[model samples]
Target: MSQGPAPRVLSDEALSELLGGQQFGTLATNKRSGHPHLTTMLYKWDPEARVLRFSTTADRIKVKQLRRDPRAALHVSGGDVWSFAVAEGEAEVSEVTTVPGDSTGQELLAMVRGSVDPADEDAFLQQLVDERRVVIRLKVQRLYGTALDVNG
Candidate 1:
């Protein structure tokens, strides 16, 4: 049997556009036992900064895992098609400090809130702040993806 055509590769511009949307992605991290721990995440892709930002609370297991091991992978896919992207990188965790209000943290939160719920942004922002949420900054070492037709 013939193996299908080679997977189509996505351009940098295309990958940037795809990640800029409000779609959720699956973030993969390593657990203490060396098993893969995955969770659905809302991410902010900053092409200029070459980093991906995601939020989680301090009590979350992923946060602890990442604190112990910075390695992570974030995968975003198109629901209607076979297109997908993978970002492999190291993570840095920072608690959102509302007292002093970290500039980078504020900006990241705004980007995430704006994308996820612009209509009710105030409530969402407050909830994030109240929850003691932390931001995960992924410094991307590699990026690869495909935007290919499945039926072709």
Candidate 2:
């Protein structure tokens, strides 16, 4: 049985590039009572270090759920492009105390916004920061990404 991570058919660079499309995926975690909690999110598969990082509002049930438990799973897919990635790990919560430069700034900002509402995203973000929603970092232990062969 091919177990633990995915087959390394694609190189790290290819995998990273594949994951760079910013696919909106679902995240799942377990509660103390064994109930599963799931939330939609935007994520990136950092192939260099094989880390999956994502952002979410701290006040959300997902965040609260994480506080109760750290285990997490992410499902990422990018349309008909035939790319998908899955990751499992311990979600670490912290304040995103750093800002990005021009290149990454837009992406980072988009992530922050995507985590919340658009009507008052800034206020929501500020509230998130005030309420400490600044970061939703997940430290992955196991990950696997495969380029789905639709024809197969």
Candidate 3:
């Protein structure tokens, strides 16, 4: 199998930076009625595979819509720094990875540091898991954005 695209659209380093920037984007999915549903999310980037992964509830409206139609788009932009990344492609939702409440708590705290307290980690995780359902991995089939045509 091919290791990657003919020309790496986004370098591994750049992808990692994108993730570290904590730059969230509005993920838009088509509802059954053919309207859009948007939501904010934090993503994990896998450099070697060049994939972006994020989690959401299985019963979420967006997730349900995605099941009906896999097409979706991600709108990412920055203000402090003038930048943007817009990607449109298909999405896949994995079976919920049953992580322990404490582990999920730690991951959440890491994502939003001081906002959460160490003491309430377990309780918060349990609450979140009880509410949300699945983990989503978005494989970007086409990525287009500012600062992307450096070589061209």
Regions of model 3 farther than 4 Å from truth: 1-20, 79-82, 97-129, 147-152
Native-to-model Cα distance after best TM-score fit, residue 93 in candidate 1, in Å: 0.4
After the best TM-score superposition of candidate 1, give how far the Cα of residue 140 lies from its true spot, in angstroms.
Answer: 1.2
| Candidate 2 CA-lDDT value | 0.62
What is residue 29's positional error in candidate 1, in angstroms?
Answer: 0.5
Which candidate leads the pack in lDDT? 1
lDDT tens string, model 3, 31-149? 87788888987665554565666667777887878788888887666333335566677888765435545444444445455666878766666766676546566777766544322
- lDDT by residue (1-152, candidate 1, tens digit) is 98876778988777777777645899999998899999999888888888998877878899989999999999998555578888899999986645323563466557655366656655666676677778889998888899766684
Question: Relative to the true structure, how large is the alpha-carbon lDDT of every model?
Answer: 0.79, 0.62, 0.63
Q: Using Cα atoms with residue i matched to residue i, what is each candidate's TM-score against the true structure?
A: 0.79, 0.61, 0.62
Query: Where does candidate 3 clash, by residue pair?
Result: 57-133
lDDT of 3: 0.63
Candidate 2, residues 36-93, lDDT tens digits: the string is 8777876765566656666555567777778888888887664555666666778876
Candidate 1 regions with alpha-carbon error over 4 angstroms: 1-3, 96-105, 113-126, 150-152
Model 2, residue pairs in steric clash: none
